[model samples]
Target: MSFLAPIPLPAPLTTRALNALRRDIVTTRLAPGETLSEATTAERLNLGKAPIRAALAQLAAEGLVQPVPRRGWIVSLVTVRDIHEVFDLRLLLEPEAARRAAASAQDRAAAAAPERLDAVCRAGYRPEDPASALGFLEANRAFHVAVAELSGNARLARQIGRLLDESTRMLVLGLRRRDRSGEMAHEHRALTAALAAGDAAGAAALMREQVAASRAMVLAALTVPDAATVA
Candidate 1:
């Protein structure tokens, strides 16, 4: 019904800095492949350099930022290849999770999971508003994670969550350019229907279609950027 507890988080200052930097990176405020300086970022965020350093290291580990030798840091550059790889993995995993999730749905609470996540998504996503991207992505992440969890495989659920996190920048890139209209909602609705009907095969097929659509949409969004091209 809700998310599982994550591992121990960083210290408060580090956590704050990490959250701010991650938000900027994922939303393209800190554009992909854009350089970052610890001092500059610390001053911009009105935080200490130590915390910023810690945050950047964390981001690097998460593949959201790249560490440069002698130079400062750069936001990780996303490519079509990267999207292809992530989505390819998702294609292998998510449909199976959906099939299992639908098969496991035997209670009222289980049946309502998709709709609950849909409410969060509908509230957070607004096509005209760039600021809503983060909330929408979080809701989207929740929706996918819930489905994977319902599959009764903790490892699968965790892997799905990580893939969603890795796809954040791509989703934000697409969302910022208004690349997707109503496709996501329609896919989710159909998937939800299949899940509610306890159609395992149907749910799997719908999820596969949804993931493929997302890959295409995000790849299109990559073309809008003036920095390094993705292909």
Candidate 2:
């Protein structure tokens, strides 16, 4: 009797697994403090248990997932304190990064950031559509991260990226409650103009304002009753 050969497994799924979990967390689909089962996740994503475990480990390093004593991993909750801490760090880093980026605007790579930011601003935010909101959030993160990268400091870009990642869920929550995407787009537009003009001080000031506004909106949203389930 002839037997069929077993199907070969796909290439490493760690990146795909990580991205799926990350998107779920940020979108609040998994909800904060929810327990995660590797086997269940593996089945849900149609991935192997090894990749799910690996993804969880990666997320733990990023502060999005925490291992419990006996239970499986739990999604980390974003506290008011966490919001303040993240914004405080952003206030310290992003303004300086923007200033440096503006100074380095003459560089070909750095000069391209303004165009990217313009594209994001043009995309705007869509409150009526959930998918559009997620798209806008991704674009928003890309724009900020791009500005940091334009500073020509790899370490600084990485730091800003981490801060942005941590703050994403809260930003999404705030966006769902409030429609400030237009104002956000306007701010981004002005910031891009400043960066393109090589105005270091202006760019720094604009970055500070953007971070401050985001902090205010997020914190305000979190204070409302039952806001955690708002999304």
Candidate 3:
């Protein structure tokens, strides 16, 4: 007789639940200020309540969800403050990183960079398919992380990865309001070409422009009380 585990293990189950919940929240499928119930989440994910509950706590720590006194959990709101803070850091960090990437990148990496960007752009957002939006978001984040990593600074790369996570919801919400896939693709191509060609100045300039454009899109997609200043 073949031996098999009777039930799903807690650690793997919690990780599975966490990934599902985080993906939904980051994609804005769970939306800002939306309430979540452990039971409902468990049922929806076909997971156990304990794992879902544990996942919620982890998300709460990540600022993606908040615990209510009476209610279960709520997805945290995307604020103007959040957008400004994140973009400010990106403006300070990413262009420098991109410049360094071009400075350090090998000839073979230069050849590969544009091809990588091409693959990523091919998975751009499709209005009819929600999954495609998720694919685009994930691909975009990975591309940024790769750029940072090529910069030859591990710390900077790790920070960029974390910042990308914080920005994913904003990116998805902006996508919902308006698709910028074409512009994004074009910008990415230019940036990648500059990086691969070992043009440090050009890469930095392109990265700055891309970050600025992304900030504008997210701010425009948001409808906070200070609507006039968003422009």
Better of 1 and 2 by TM-score: 2
lDDT of 2 by residue, 1-231 (tens): 337877755346988999999999987788887899888999999999988988999899888999997788999887888889999999999999999999988865544677787986666566778667777878888899989988889999999998998788888888878877888889899999999999999999999999999999998888788766332
Best by lDDT: 2
Q: 125, model 1: CA deviation in Å?
A: 4.2
Predicted candidate 3 versus true structure: per-residue lDDT over 107-178, tens digit per residue: 444557667765766666788886787898888888888889888899999999888998888888888777
**Residue by residue across 113-170, what tens digits does model 1's lDDT show?**
7677567556446767767667777777777887888889999999998888778778
Q: Output the better candidate (2/3) by TM-score.
A: 2
Give me the runs in candidate 3 sitting further than 4 Å from their true place: 1-10, 107-111, 128-131, 224-231
Query: Positional deviation of 144 in candidate 1, in angstroms?
Result: 1.5
Candidate 2 — worst ten consecutive residues by lDDT sum? 1-10
Error of 1 at 220 (Å): 2.4
| Candidate 1 local lDDT, residue 140 | 75
Error of 1 at 221 (Å): 2.7
